[model samples]
Target: MTDRLKDFIENNADGFNDLEPSQDSWNKIAARIGHSEKVRNKKLRYISIVSAACIAGIAAFIIFFGKPQNQTDNFAEIPEVLEAEAYYTSQINMKKEQVYQMAGNFPELKNEMEVDLAELDTIMVELKKDLNDNVSNSEVVEAMIQNYRMKLMILEEIKSFLETKTDDQKNTTSYEL
Candidate 1:
């Protein structure tokens, strides 16, 4: 079989040599290669342009809006509001501790108090944001101070209620004993 294949190939070698590719076919192949190369170059150029645009957009955003603001700096502009906030915050903390201590046996009451305080805190945060946006706006600063005062009021009310309930419980227990 090998000898037969070798003889067949030797006899057909001249026919194979005579069958050369046409000039038009060679030109078509070259054109396809060139077209694909052009498409690749176009794709590369588009990708680079988009990347540059994205980088420039990000840089502009950082340059325009990345300034850091100090929390104390805003409050420093209004010393009275700052002092009021500090006083009310300390008072609220003290009252909260007292209420929590008295409410150790009343989980539901404690939870309710916490929820009320949290709502006030949320409002205070919004007021603070407004104040920071316009430090010179006395209305916003007043609102912020009022928020603190309201928080202190709520804490005081809770503390007073708990103390009254504690006193009533002590009196009832003493009478029972």
Candidate 2:
């Protein structure tokens, strides 16, 4: 079939080569495609403008009607916690980092202490939840503050212990030569 088609093309090659569309026909086709592209572009521009306007209206509504934020440490409902929450939390984070770095040398000890610390953190979270629900639970607030202090002290002790162990290991290794 392909061979027959090839033979037909060869026979009609002169007629095919001699025939060409008029310039007006080419211009008409170009105008049709160009007009459709322009319409598509305009539609996209209109859609983008509508979307932007909708987003701006929603944002304005939120800004004008939203309540002022009052942040607390895991206690969103309490705003009078003396801002000590932020300070203690940051200190805990710094100590946690130190403990993590020291864990590379003392995995067993760090793991053991981490288990205890996790329990204390769980307790603190529960206390924070209580404060969120009540906003003025004296006992839970006290317990949470104590937990933070305990964690800080524990981290400091662990850091000291790791430093001493690392120094002893270095000294013992060096003296063997």
Candidate 3:
């Protein structure tokens, strides 16, 4: 079919080559296709902004309103778990401060290595909810603990990378004039 169409175009080239649709026809075509570039861009920007806002709103909702009731009966190892949680939270906070300082020294590195801690935190919260419903479930408790450990590990790795990077710069004694 494409070959037939090509032959037809070749045979009828003289008839169509000089044909010009008028300005009115062009305007009608543009109207039918909604061909204004600015209009398309504006719609795109609007959609992007709205989509971002929706994501932020949903995240906020999960963080703030998704927690189950705080009944002590829901967790078996409450004291030990809470203590571990506190320790990991403190470690994460310390690393965040370090990341803040590192960001000043290495903006691109900080941006590239950063993780969405909020999402992890949200999953941690959701796991707590699951733990609440299943007090005897050791797996859920282990998962929650694992999440905390994973977060601390990530933070420590970033800190170690930044520290080594700075140390490397300090150890390098060469300068080109």
Candidate 4:
């Protein structure tokens, strides 16, 4: 059987060679394969582009609109700043309380003090944001301390003014008596 098959192939080899496919047929097959490949490549390119755009959009969203990290964690690392902030905060609260008590008869003065303190509070908030954005900005921390000092100074001055006014009233009453 093997000898017969070999003999048949030898006899028909020339005929098989003579019946080769046309060049046009080869070109058509090549063109079809090439076109399919091009379509596949285009689909792949579009998928990759869309995927990249989605990744970039997600990254931007997380950067711009994500929940803010706790700022106290950053401040915790700076013990001196924390101590100063606590100290100044306590002092400021005490002084503000004293000023409020003394300025009961002076609503205008209280309002003025609130306006000034509010401005300082706004500045302090901006400084805190700056500090959060840049974890350890010494200048911003110093500015925050200075802002506290200014608030304390304003309260002290108002308290002194009220004290003098009270003393003057007392002296006038004594002289009248």
Measured by TM-score, the strongest candidate is: 4
Query: Residues 45-105, candidate 1, lDDT per residue (tens digit)?
Result: 4443443344334333433543444445565356787787778888889888888888897
Higher-ranked by lDDT: 2 or 4: 4
Which candidate should be chosen as best, given lDDT against the real structure? 4
Off by over 4 Å in 3: 1-72, 112-114, 173-177
Stretch of 10 with least lDDT, candidate 4: 51-60
Error of 1 at 164 (Å): 1.5
Per-residue error (Å), model 2, residue 142: 1.4
User: Which regions of candidate 1 are displaced past 4 Å?
Assistant: 1-76
Tens-digit lDDT track of model 4 for 1-177: 379988998989987688767769966785677644345435434443443344344334444554555455565358898899899999999999988888888786677678677766766666676667753365556567667777776677677767877787779967995
Candidate 3: tens digits of C-alpha lDDT, residues 130-163 = 6666533455566666666656655565577667
Count of backbone collisions in candidate 1: 0
TM-score of 4: 0.56
Error of 3 at 148 (Å): 0.9
Per-residue alpha-carbon lDDT of model 2 for 4-108, expressed as tens digits? 988999999897799778869966785677644345435434443443344334334433443433544444445556466777889989988987887696666
- Which residue pairs does candidate 3 place in steric collision? none
Model 2: how far residue 63 lies from native, Å: 38
* lDDT order of candidates, top first: 4, 2, 1, 3
Runs in model 4 deviating more than 4 A are 1-76
Screening candidate 2 with a backbone cut-off below 3 angstroms (N, C-alpha, C), the clashing residue pairs are none
